[model samples]
Target: MSIKSKPTLQDVARMAGVSSMTVSRALTKPDIVSEQTRQKIDHAVRELGYVPNLAASQLVTRRSGIVGALITTITNPILATTIETLQQGLARAGFHMLIGETRFSQEEEGKLLRAFLGRQLDGLILAYGYHSPETLELLQAAEIPVIELWDLPEGEVPRQPVGQVVGFSNWAAGASAGRHLVACGYRKPAFFGYDDERENLRFQGFRRAVLDGLGVEPQRYKTSAIPSIEDGVDMIERLARGELDCDAAFFTNDMQAIGALFACQRLGIAVPQTLGICGFGDLPIARVAAPSLTSVRIPAEKVANSTVELLCQRIKGEEPWAANIDVGSELVARESTALRR
Candidate 1:
């Protein structure tokens, strides 16, 4: 027996003894079609191995069914989890995610935003804090729902006439870290943070909390470049050789803290005995490290889910309240920062 030609809607209609339009209605809008007709169309589709072209169907529905996402980088573990969760949430809502990485450049973000707009995306999600004037113009022209994640930029309004924003307070996250250190009885503390503005916000919060909450002004050690394990180790070594005095240090992130933990071990400095250490963003490595890192837990998955939900509501033309979601971070005291009570 010879294999038959690939089945089309016409073929399914002929097999099901219905008009092509009736078959289309049965497949696309089953509720509009009688149950018997819908079952017959489904059976015919199964028998013929007919797969409807989603793109063609979307054209008829006037829904591009795609969401454009822009972020600084994808390699970071915490960001990777956020994107994964966002994609999964969007997929459940019958939407696809188109991701673009800006590498932390405003110019690059502007270009990427233009490209996404060219694709006529259903919605937009931006991760970076800065936005170019050109990018803002494009966003205004596109007139689609845009969700800014992670940290909100200083000047931008929470919700635009055409778009929406969802984010948490970066400053609050840092303040939590400072309070944690102060509560743990670290008076002469120091801060190690990256150069990013978001990190700077955290640093400011940490500084404020130390002065206001702890009644002591903490010293700061700003990293010239991005915070990394090597930087953490180097900072510890430099501090050891200097006259600068600090009983504890709060690294900008857990990765850096873990590095400091190793450096302290090499120098024979007992953690929480002679010196204490803490970090932010309780990544997986934080928990599994030698000392089992004590850091702030930022809900990466929750942020993604909340952003997507906000975007969905915006897409449906429903005016959602300004989503200043402060999925607050909690300080998890582990062996690294815990003092024997």
Candidate 2:
């Protein structure tokens, strides 16, 4: 049997009766080429089954048409929504996304940054605003638009960002959750969360709210466990067994809150009646839990949209009017924190 060779740009140009340069422009910068010429080039490309050499095209236009995104994990419901929306938005703009998991590790993030930079990504989206010194250096020298999502930089409005930021205040969200718990008459609240910068900000805000509302300090439990239902179950079991002391508890995310709810059911502890519960990142499950959980709802979709908009603008050599976008968060009062008896 004879072997068939893959079609090339020259084949398309020949079939379309146009120069190779014209075909190249039609493929990469269709707007610049006339509509009639573009149609001929498109038909010829289809007929010849010619796939443009992306690497060769990148050399000419200095654009990879690829964007790199780094997130803590792909499993978090809140971050999952953000990633999905971001991918869809980038697709609409003729770009593709390359996702990486940092697992909240600055070192892993720095390593991924080096690898992504080697690929010459046109832009980068980071879920966390904080970065290691080496990662920051890489970003500064990369000369590409970098947009931070999920958490805003701490500063004044219109504050200068590394490049751009599209997220809400983690501190404000935690404070909102704390205030809601207090409003529901939960005194001596307990916090079950991580001891990282973002979660620490939340804890600080929560502490401030608890102090101001009830004049009592919230008991803090630092956990290095992956935010999961089992961990939440263990924490709630401890509360039930008198191992921890608090009338109310706040978790870092909804999965843990749901877990706590499960434990409460098994241990015969009525939610909101005996112990109030609140969580951040109001996942869909929080709304339908046995006793619906009250939680801070981060604007994942809004952040994703804003990140794509600003990134696309920067990639096109346009300055976004707003470099810092604070979508803000809402604390939804649900059954879990309705009232204290």
Candidate 3:
């Protein structure tokens, strides 16, 4: 047969001697179709050089083959890495990523959720903290699967989860980090954290695990916005100048903890001897920051792998997934929080 315009599914069906519905099933749900017919359709597609229109298919299937993702910020290395791995995971399953930034804003997150809903996405991945009521409504009304990236404290929220959760507890990670510093012989420790909800939860864990139970109080400093190394440097300088009181400090993240290391160097103080420091996230910077900072190693890779697998499983309509799938974290001892310190 001579073809003029771009070949369509109709051409493939006619050439293969099958109906359009059979062609559709062969392409989408091949398991139910017979092998001989599937091979015939495959050969006809190759012979006719047919390119299926994904947009047209989506119009009928109501699935864009796109997964919506909302993250706090791309600048932060942790979330950046998470998004990267998430995309790779989705791509393996023939899905593309449609990403948005919330900048830790509930309103912006709600807008993104609504926009994604409008786009007819196949599913959603939220690496964010808070959600608006409108966003919740969108999720409840959505037929696709929804996953919250952060681990919600089992019973603290006083509400059921919006969807499946595939993450670890920030509080538990923070508490373990605090305990690491204390067990290393550091007393009068301080904590540096941001004003974000997740960071605040970590702070609570640190306080309960290190302060109340250990009989040591931290010189606390909580600031708004994303924490940076400068925040760590600035806080340590104040502590060095006797304006703050703490021989050691625990940071909500590695960026701040690494900052404290730089500040200690500037203040002519020795690490592990004069000051003990611990950070969360166990980011790569933690490993090369001179003394190699101690940190809570969040299983980000495992989290990514599991998140993708779990989301795909649900997308395939798999049932009986646990309410919360915890990919827990671990504490690493390093020179920064040496036992001799």
Candidate 4:
């Protein structure tokens, strides 16, 4: 067969020295076919670049075998773990995932959702809970199993989730970091992060903790830019220049915290002594940084497993035992925040 020509099932079977029915059974129901014959069919398909007609398969099975995932950005190391795990889990269950970057915009998310819906995906997995009204309406109309990640409302019913929700409380994670800073004997802590709604919840929790523990409100420093190491470096530089007044700072994620640590070293500011630092999302670098970072650890794998399990259940026309699953977060104490009182 010419490599440029579209290969068919007969071509594959002819190359593999098997009948068309045997090749079909091997591809669709391999368990019933002998291992030796299945290997020949696979080798022939690979050589010919044969692509199965997913349209025909879907028409018969009523399943597209595809899931759509939307996230803020692929650059954030913190979210990378969850996405990798979700992809692996979905692939294990014979489902392929198509991912889109929303860049934290409702308009972009809605556009991606519409594109995915047109393909008739079996389900969708979203990074955060908040969505545009149009996006919500689309999900309602699609009526497929949807899983929202990263911001579960604690003890309160969510207005979204046409299906299941799996995530931790951002507010709680921030509060834990704030209390950790207080325990380290730092006063006048400040929040340094993005101005997104989810980031705002973390700031609110951190503020509540600082107010209760230190009897003073923490300062707020925010930017609309996505949180990055450069942002963290700039924040520390501002503090050194007296542009901000705070003894400690809680950042949005480990990237910022790691950046702050590097900046402190360059500026001669002693961490946990002259300035304390903490961050959310205990990315791998947090454990190995010079002073190490104090951060909140989100259960990425747990969330992934639960999300896949629930989504599969919904796909099977079964209701999940529970709609909301809060895997929760934990504060990891480390050298960066180990201030001596």
Candidate 5:
């Protein structure tokens, strides 16, 4: 039951009938070794299951071979999917991910940023909006490639920069959502959201579209400081109590929509009959829910891929276009808001 020992460079060198230095050169600097010798070293390494020590190699290269990811929360499904995609894509490019969650707190984000700065991270990926000026300054001074996702800043991109960013326009996506809801015949639609700045942008877009396109002013919608399943349930309960009134509702994210759906079921409110529900982020659970959720697909994987690509380019001293880039979102309709028969 003892664990087997890891095969070392000496084992491969012995099997290949070559010096350890020669085997190392064949594995790392293949150009310095003959093709025949390289092939022999490769075969020996494969037979012995000898893997290169990345940490040791990184010491000489002065690169950590690791990427730091700062996220608002770990429990968010959409963010989880995006991070998963990013990790997979980064791994393919010979990089590992070091994750830190801030729970959507600026103070926590600053602390995490400082901690990661001490590490040997080659790059940084932020999942939420940049709000901390100190953290931004540190990132700029570090000169490492930094990519921001999910949320984009409202004002002009700062001149003192870190690296490239790949994200979608949250305001535009919200406006699109508003248009879709209005086109689908929702007049008295309400927005259910969190107090985050990005969510505020979406709310503003929704308001603008409803006022301009629909020519109707939406009533005050139910919102919470923290958008979670429990908050969703509380909002629905209040609605049942006649505190809120709406024929259709737009949730900040799919998690809240799922919560609202469950609450509707518990209250015996016929979905898309007595009320309609829509959410942002086309999470997997959205499809599995009863009367599948109608939501906006955020292109999480594509954003992750593009972010890593841009970061790599920046790391290589390649000048990319703009620091900020926006990808578009798509509206996916499902039974939650299906047309009435």
Candidate 6:
């Protein structure tokens, strides 16, 4: 099929019986054009399904009005909430969001970074933490504001980022889960989650916490792919059948923790009594899970608020009050790790 040519300002002008300048004025500054002219242009635009050229507006303003975001996935609630809030804040500040999926890989992010730079993004927000050497060079060369979200890289939770970081300590979040389990009197514990760059950071933190708090390192059961409910359930079944030697477990997130609950029910493994489970992210379901999951809470909205503030400062060529901000985290004690139960 032959493709129809895109309707331009000239085409709209022709249909409305006006000059291109008149059509532009009607679309942008309607008050400068007569009501009759605007009505004619509007009718023409609707009939032709003409869309406004946002690129032209960007060129004139020297601001792309496009903020590029690289997130692992929209399926995960933590990243999804932060991305949605970031978009809303950017929109309020007269910017649009263009998102790229990275799936927590530096390689995937590197490709998306190149594409975003080609698109002339005004800023970038990243959910994934790792950056390849080439990706770092590209970002440094681009000289645009980049906000790294989610977690700090290489146990640099307290280190101020060179660009800007709007995240908490992934290690610390995981550590809290481990420490809480130890406090609940669990002698043996396991760590089950995705084996990725950031998840490794969590694993490290959890191990340190478990070793220090209970003098025992957690048994690691990891997947190279993204951790899902199915992975959690299957891992739990294995543990239930005496496959993994651990009495309690801390998962990377609540989905897996809840799945473990199902496995326990199926295998008649008593939670807290025989097995204690803790999770990260403190998702809503954690509170309502069969035994109420113990989890670490990251403040998504609070992080978004800080991210937008930093972006706005950078956009206006002003230094932020602080280059890196730790939004902080909390541990939600729940029935799953109850000491009395």
Whole-model lDDT values for every prediction: 0.79, 0.86, 0.81, 0.86, 0.80, 0.81
- True-structure lDDT of candidate 6: 0.81
- Per-residue C-alpha lDDT of model 4 across residues 1-341, encoded as one tens digit per residue: 66777999999999999999999777655657898998899999999999988899889879888999999888888778889999988875668899999988899999999999999999999987888899999999998889888887643343555556898887888899888899889878888888876787888889889999999978999854566888889988988999999988898878888888999999999998899898888998999898989899998889988999899888878868787898989999999889666
lDDT of 2 at 121: 98
What is the TM-score of candidate 3?
0.83
Higher-TM-score candidate of 2 and 6? 2
Query: What is candidate 4's TM-score against the reference?
Result: 0.89
Candidate scoring better on lDDT of 4 and 5:
4
Number of colliding residue pairs in model 3: 0
Candidate 2's error at 150, in angstroms? 1.7
- Model 3 per-residue lDDT tens digits across residues 82-135: 888998888767678999988778888988888888888888998864677887
**Superposing all C-alpha atoms, what RMSD in Å does each candidate have to the true structure?**
4.9, 3.6, 4.8, 3.0, 4.5, 5.2
Q: Give the count of colliding residue pairs in each prediction.
A: 0, 0, 0, 0, 0, 0
Spell out the clash pairs found in candidate 3: none
Segments in model 1 whose C-alpha atoms lie over 4 Å from true places: 1-55, 152-163, 213-216, 224-227, 243-245
Error of 1 at 143 (Å): 0.9
**Model 2 misplaced regions, further than 4 Å:** 8-50, 155-161
Best of the two (1, 3) by lDDT: 3
**Candidates sorted on TM-score, descending:** 4, 2, 5, 3, 6, 1
Q: Which regions of candidate 6 are displaced past 4 Å?
A: 1-50, 153-162
TM-score of each: 0.80, 0.88, 0.83, 0.89, 0.84, 0.82
Assess candidate 5 and give its lDDT: 0.80
Higher TM-score: candidate 2 or 4? 4
